[model samples]
Target: MAQIDWETLAGRVENAPSLLRLWDALEDYAQACRDVGCTEAECGLDLRRLPTYGGEWTGEYLFPIRDDGITIRSHDETHMLLDRERAEPRYVVVPRSAYNL
Candidate 1:
């Protein structure tokens, strides 16, 4: 797996227009990785392992977005979630098809 530069990612996220667009960029990157035959683990772009608020792992790619103290909701439809008020976030690009799963 490739090492992530948290500081760099924080900067990018801070400057990004929206989390959804950032997710798109990640999806593109993951596609490029697969084009070269890199596995999700080897490419270090597994969305399932992404970190979430309070130092928790997502376990799956899509989940819910809740307020600082509210409960998280799970949706059956495919989409990406973002929490800007929590600790700094880290993300990776996965194919769009990953969202359908």
Candidate 2:
């Protein structure tokens, strides 16, 4: 799995508070995976109907971990990023999808 830098992520979603919590959650999930001896690629955490942008939007956070990186995606038209460590969790905030449907 790939790793990411937290500072860079904090830059992108600095205004999105919920994403910060989501970031912490992702970290916990990653740690849990390590504790269980599961590969990050095989790990996932599905967040259903999470509130974002101060209730302006609500969507699911689909976290699919991979050997190369981890994706923090929303079921709606959005996504964000959070990082771990060297070459084990490179994160990327996938810009919001253009289509609503």
The candidate maximizing TM-score is 2
Spell out the clash pairs found in candidate 2: 1-67, 1-88, 2-88, 2-89, 2-90, 3-88, 3-89, 3-90, 4-89
Compared with the true structure, what per-residue lDDT tens digits does model 1 show for residues 38-75? 64346554444343322223464344334452112121
Candidate 2 residue-wise lDDT, 15-97, digit = tens: 33565555555555556567767644454433333334432344444444455344344322344453323455444344444
Per-candidate Cα lDDT values, in order, are: 0.41, 0.44
TM-scores for all candidates? Answer: 0.32, 0.36
Candidate 1: deviation at residue 87, Å? Answer: 31
What is the Cα-based lDDT of residue 76 in candidate 1? 20
Candidate 2 local distance difference test against the native:
0.44
